[model samples]
Target: MRTKSEARKDAIMSVALEVFREVGFDAASMSQIAARVGGSKATLYNYFSSKEELLLEAMLHSAEQHAENVLQLLQTEGDFSQQLHSFVASLLTLVNAPETVEILRVAISVGGTTDVGRRFYESGTQHVWTEISSKLQEEIKKGSLRDVDADRMAMHLRCLCEAEMIRNLLGAHQRMSASEAREKADCIIDIFLHAYGSTR
Candidate 1:
C-alpha cells in the first residue's frame, strides 16, 4: 500500500526527529541525520531543503495524530461549557505530550532568528486557535458568552489550557491523568465562563 519513496521519506523524518530531540536544532546537522538514516546527504537534501525544514516536517509528522484527535474532540457536539472543558482537557493532553513539548521548545528557541517559529505557528497553532475563536463567536451570537472579541476570548482559553505548558517544555511537568485533566479543565472553564458568561 505504501510506495518505497514514501517509506524512505518516513524513515528519514523519524530519524530526524530523534536527532532533533537528542541535540536540539542548533546542534543537529543534516550530515548527522543522513548518517543516522543510512543515506547520503544529497539524498537527505532531496527529501528536505534544509535542516530547519526537516525539523519542522519531522515534528509535525510526529504530532499529527494527537493534533488531529484534539481537533476532532473540538467538533463533538455538547453544551458550550462542556465542550470548552472537553476541548481544554484534550488540548492539555496534546501539549503535554513529550514530542509536542519538544517541538514547542524548538519553535521558541529558533523563532527569534528564523522563519521556523512563524511557519510552525501559522501551520498548526494558528489553525487550532482559529477553531476555538469560531466556537466562541458562535456562542457569542447565541448570547451564551459575552459579546467580546472572539479571537481574544479564544486566546484567553488557550492561555488557560497551556498554563502548565512551560513546565512540560522544561521537562518538569507531571503529566496529568484523565481525572486530573478534567478537573483542571473544569477550573479553566469556570474562570473563562465567569469572565465571559452573558448576564442574561
Candidate 2:
C-alpha cells in the first residue's frame, strides 16, 4: 500500500536514473530530469533536495531492487557451498550489469566532489556486506565454515567476488557469459571454502 507521495517519488527517481544514465552526473540537470518526468523542478525538489540527493536516491533505488534478488540466493536452502556459489553467481550478474557499472562509475566520478560516493558506499555496499556477514555467521554457527570472524570473512568473499569488477567497469573486457559467471562463482567459493570450510 504505497502512498501517492511515495509512488510519485519513485517515478521521479526512475526518470532521474534514466537522465543520469544518459548525461551522467555532472552534465545532468534537475530541469532535465523534471522535464523528462513531466513535472516541474519544484516538484522534484519537493521529493529531493538537490540533484546529488536525487542521484543518490535513484542509484540506491535501483540497487535495492537488484540486491533483493541477490540476497535471496543466499538463503539457507542448501549446503553452505551451494548458498555461496549461488550468491556469488547472482552477485556477479548484478555487478556486471550495465546499469550497475554505470552507477558505480557515476558514483566514483563524484566521489571526491560530493558525499554521495561515500554515502552510497555506506548505505549500499556496506549494507549488502552486512547482510552477507550475517549469512556467513550463520554458517559458522552451523559448523559449515571455520570459526573465524564472520564479518572479515564476508569482506574477503566480497573482495574475491568483485575481483574483476574494476576491469568490467573500465571496459577492459567483455561482459561474462552465464557459464563464465557461474564458473567464476565456483572458483570464488572454492577459494573461500579452502580457507574457511570447517575441517570437521
Candidate 3:
C-alpha cells in the first residue's frame, strides 16, 4: 500500500500532466496546476519547488515506472523472440498512455533553445535509450540476441519502436493488437540476427 504522501504526490503529478498537456510546460503556471489539484499555489510549491522541477519530476516518474515494468518483464522466463515480444509490449504500453503522450508533447514544446529543457531532453528522455541499450546488452549476454554494440542497436530499436508509438499517438494505431506488435518484434529480431546473430 502506498503512504498518503506518495499517493498525494501521484495525484498531483496526474493533475499536472493534464494541465501541462493542455497548456504546455512553460505556458502552464503553478497556480494552474494547484487549482487543477484542488490546492493553493503555496501548497503546490511545498511539493514541487518550481514548474520546471514539477515537469522534470513528472516525466522522470513515468520513466522510472516504465523501467521497473520492463525489468519485471525481463525477469520472466522466455526465449529470444518471446523476450523481444515482451519488451515491445512493455514499451508500447507505456508510450501509448494518453497521459504519457501528453507529457511528451509538453516536453517537446519546451524546444531545444533553453538550457533546462535541453538538459531534460538529453539526460531525462534520452536516458531511456541508454536504459534500453543496457537491456539489449543483458539480453545479448543471455544469448537472446546477437552480439552487437548495444548502444547502436538500442538507437535503431528506438527508431523502430518510436515510429510506431508516435503513430499510435496520432490515432493511426489502436494499441496495435498484441499479435501485430509481436510480429513487429519478430521482424526486428530477424533484422538483428541478420546483422549479428550467431552463425553455426
Candidate 4:
C-alpha cells in the first residue's frame, strides 16, 4: 500500500502532467501546476523541487505505466510470435498517442539545448529497453531464441516495430489506427521470428 505522502506525490504528478500537456514544458510554470493540483507553490515545491524535476517525474510515470503493460505481455506464457505481436501493438499504441507525440516533440525540441532529453532517455526509453532485453536473455537461456546480444536484439525489435510508423509520425502523416497498428505489429514480429528464431 502506498503511504499518504506517496499518494499525494502521485496526485501532484498527475496534475502536473495535465498542466504540462496544456502549455508545454517551456511555457508551463510550477504555479500553473500547483493551481491545478489544489495546492500552494510551496506545497508543490515540497514534492518536486523544480518544474523540470516534476516534468521528468510525470513523463516517467506515464512511461512506467505503459512499460508495465508491455512487460506483463512479454512475461506471459504463450507462443513467442503471439507475445511479440502483443508487445509491439501495445508499444505502438502508446507511442502514437497524441499526448505522447506532443511530449516527444517537446523533448526533441529541447533535447540538444537541455539535459531534459538525456534524463528522459535514461529514465524512460533506456529503462524499457533494459527490461525487454532481460526478457530476451531469458528466452536465449531457454533455447527459444537465437544466441545473440539481448540488448541489441531488443533494440532491433523496437526499431523494426516502429520503423515506418515512426517515420510517418515525424513526417506529420496520419496517425495509425488500432487495426493498422496490429497488422504492422504482426508483420514486424513475423520478420523478427524468421530472423531470430532458434536454429536448433
Candidate 5:
C-alpha cells in the first residue's frame, strides 16, 4: 500500500545513511548524497530541507525498523532464552555493519550540537533500549527469565555490552569480524544466562 514517492524516499534515505556514515555530517555534502542517489542537489533538497533533516530521518528509519523487528521477534517466538539470543544476534548485526558504525561515529561527533543528533539518540538508541526493556519485562512475567527489574536490567545490558562495543566496532580493521563479535557477545550473554535464564 505504500506509494512510489514513499519508496523513493526510502531509497534516498538509505543512500543518505551510507554517505553520512562515510563522510560524517560536517564533511558530507548534499551534493555528495545526490550523486550517490543519482539525483541533483536541488532534487535532494526538495525531498529534505537540510542535511540535519535527512540524517534525523535516516536515524529514525533505522530505529523504527529495529524496534519493529525486535518486537516481532518477541511476539512470534515462544522461548525466552531463544528470543534473547535472537535479539542479541540481530541487534549486533545492525550495530556491527560498517555503515552503522559510521552512523554512530558521525552521531557522536555531532550529537551534542544538532536537532538531528538529539533526535537520533532519543528515537534510535534510547528507543531500542526501551523496546528491549519491555521485552525483558514480558519474559520475567512469563517466568521464563529471572524476576528482575526490567529497566535496570536493560540499562545494565546496554551499558555493559554496547558501551564496550563501540570501541570494538570502531577498531583499526574497520569493524568487528564475526568471530570477534561472537566472543564479545558470548561473555555478556553468559551474564544474561546467569541472571535471567530459566531456573527450576
Candidate 6:
C-alpha cells in the first residue's frame, strides 16, 4: 500500500545503495544514482537533499529489511536461549554480508565530519535496540529474565554478540560462516542467560 511518491523514493534509495556499493561512497554522485534510478538529478534531489542524506537513508533501508526477520525471531514463541540464538545468528548473517560491510565502512569513514553516522544510528541501530529492549522487558515481566534495565541489558547482549563479528567486518578476520555465527550466538546466549535468568 505504498503511494507513488513513496514507491519512487524506495526505488531511488535502492538504486543509490547499488551505486554506492559499485563505486565507493566518496566517488558516487547523485547524477550516477539518478541515472540508474531512471530519473533526473532534480527529481533525485526532490527525494534526497544530498548524497550523504541518500546514503544514510539507503543504509537505514537495508537495515530495516534485514531486521524484519530478526524482529520476528525475537518475538516468536520459544525458549529465551533459542530465541536469542536465532536473533543473533540472523543479525550476524545480515551484518556480515559484503554489501552491509561496505555500507558500514562508508559510515565509519564519514562518521567524524558528517551527520551520516548519527542519522544511521538513530534511524537503524537505535530502532533495533528499542525493539529488542521492549522484548526483554516483556521477558522480565514474565519472570523468564531477571529484573534489570531492559535497555542496558539489550545493549549488553548486542555488544556480546558483535564482539568478534565487528572485528571481522573491520577485516581483522574472515567473515563468519552461518555455523560459526550460530555457535558464537549460542555461547553468548548461554553467558547472558546465566547472568540474567530469573534464578540468577
Model 3 is weakest, by summed lDDT over 10 consecutive residues, at 168-177
In model 2, the runs with Cα more than 4 Å from the true position are none
Q: For each candidate in the order shown, give its overall lDDT on alpha carbons.
A: 0.83, 0.87, 0.73, 0.82, 0.76, 0.84
Prediction 6 global C-alpha lDDT: 0.84
lDDT of 6 by residue, 1-200 (tens): 88999999999989888888777788999888888888799998898888898999888888898888789998877687788789988887776777777777778778888999988998898999899999999999999999989998998888886676567556775666899888877888888888888984
Per-model TM-score, in order, reads: 0.86, 0.96, 0.80, 0.91, 0.84, 0.91
Show pairs that collide, candidate 6: none
Candidate structures ordered by lDDT, highest first: 2, 6, 1, 4, 5, 3
Candidate 4 — what's its lDDT? 0.82
Instruction: Compare the candidates by lDDT and give the number of the best one.
Output: 2
The residue-by-residue lDDT of candidate 4 on 23-94, one tens digit each, is 778898888878887888999889877877888888888889878887799888878778878889988877
Clashes of each: 0, 0, 0, 0, 0, 0
How much is 77 displaced in model 1, in angstroms?
2.1
lDDT by residue (tens digit), candidate 1, 87-172: 78887777776777776787788989888888777876787788779878999999999999999998888889888887788789
Candidate 1 regions exceeding 4 Å error are 1-4, 62-64
Q: Report the C-alpha displacement of residue 32, candidate 4, in angstroms.
A: 1.1
C-alpha displacement of 74 in model 5, angstroms? Answer: 2.9
Model 3 TM-score relative to the real fold: 0.80
Segments of candidate 6 deviating more than 4 angstroms: none
Residue 124, candidate 4: alpha-carbon lDDT? 91
Model 4 misplaced stretches (Cα beyond 4 Å): 164-173
